[model samples]
Target: MQPITPFFMFEGNAEEAMNFYLSIFEGASISHITRYGANEVGKEGSVQQAIFTLNGQTFMCIDSPIKHDFTFTPALSLYITCDTEEEIDRLYGALSIGGAVLMPINAYPFTQKFAWFNDQFGVSWQLNLPGKGEGF
Candidate 1:
């Protein structure tokens, strides 16, 4: 199966935030943090980034540099293709907690069932459940 993962950009506290996430989610594993050296793009010894895996999905995070413009937008949302209605509902509810819902979970013209929301972490997601005529 193909897995869809998201990469988030943090101001400078990526390590702390990622650690906090690992603490909240059971079975979350964080890889060792890597630093930039003279051979890298940024200043030597600067923290490069790390990767965190929750359940089986991987998320990559990095500290945003002064030169990079990092902003979260709806256009960059991560789509979760759910297999069942119950699964979709469960995830939709969990992700919507403490977050704003841009599109309520419901049936749409183009899709049988779909929901769009921005999670508490400022990440956008589009949850979709295929219809009768849909293809995987």
Candidate 2:
């Protein structure tokens, strides 16, 4: 079976979103990108299709030609297991900006430190610093 990669569809700002994520995570890079040209279905210079990696996980994204009423929701999220409080704190501070926080960063009964929020691009994310012997 083929690997299932998470995909994102943006109206016109996929490149911006991809760059934003790359700046936040270590070892992240764009593997390939195809931009729209003149007379194309999508906006000129917008992302036609792209593949990128974040912390070793591959993801795909595109700048959609057609606009849709629907967008990303908190139901499906990118989960990150951070190794330290500093990592979680930095990530939470960076991701929470210009976004809505479903759960602010704090200690929870299930974990030592955790946060859940939707990024400016409407992508949901959860950052967790798990305690010893704990897993999520």
Candidate 3:
């Protein structure tokens, strides 16, 4: 089977969200982007499709032309295994702003530090620092 890449659909702010993520994560970059032109289905200059990588994990996203009643849900999240306290703290601070926290950063029995939240763009995320954690 081909490698599966995560995809995201944004109402109209896919570009903004992509840039925001690139700024926050190390080794993040936009690999490719196709913007809507004048009179296109989507808003002019908006992302029709974009490919980006965060810390080498590739993801696809788009500014959807069709408006829908639904958006991102917390059921599926992007999980990150952080290397240090500073790393998790920085990511949690950035991702949790203007978003709902499902679980605040704390030491749990399964992990030394962990947090789960939805980002400003409604993307769910979980940050973990494995120390005493059984599963790494």
Candidate 4:
């Protein structure tokens, strides 16, 4: 397990969200998952807990058995440093579908290219093409 990992709680779409994220990042994978059983409060087959790796950063997610109005927020977001403009563009496009863009991809003084958006699952992400000798 990673020393520190982000944990997400979804109403019922944990599996779907996990797969969607895996599809977007290369080398991503579901390391393990434990689903709700017949007698559990959650619907059978729903994710009780899951461990996933986005490239190499590990994350934990679960399908919350109880309802809550809260969700992912922009205050805290997944920040990715892209290798090229094409990569940032591709990620921005794919993640922006069915979602909203907080900052459209464009050339910025801090970075050559940058974009910030919330994915369909309401997860906020910031993608950037780092400038020389710097990280975004």
Off by over 4 Å in 1: 1-6, 12-28, 34-48, 54-57, 65-70
Choose 3 or 4, whichever is better by TM-score. Answer: 3
Runs in model 3 deviating more than 4 A are none
lDDT for predicted candidate 4 compared with the true structure:
0.90
- Put down candidate 2 lDDT per residue, 37-64, tens digits, no spaces: 9998989999999999999999999999
Clashes of 1: 0
Would you give me the overall lDDT of model 2?
0.94
Better of 1 and 3 by lDDT: 3
lDDT of 4 at 96: 82
The best candidate in terms of TM-score: 2
Count clashing residue pairs in model 4.
0
Better of 3 and 4 by lDDT: 3
CA shift of 105, model 3, Å: 0.7
| Model 4 TM-score on a 0 to 1 scale | 0.93
Q: Per-candidate TM vs. native?
A: 0.66, 0.97, 0.95, 0.93
- Compared with the true structure, all predictions reach lDDT values of 0.77, 0.94, 0.93, 0.90
Worst lDDT run of 10 residues, candidate 2, spans: 127-136
Of 2 and 4, the candidate ranking higher by TM-score = 2
User: Which pairs of residues clash in candidate 4, taking residues 3 or more apart in a chain or in different chains?
Assistant: none
Best by lDDT: 2
lDDT of 3 by residue, 16-104 (tens): 99999999988899999999999988999999999999988999999999999999998999999999899999999998999999999
Error (Å) of candidate 1 at residue 57 is 4.9
By lDDT, the candidates rank as 2, 3, 4, 1
Stronger candidate by TM-score (2 vs 3): 2
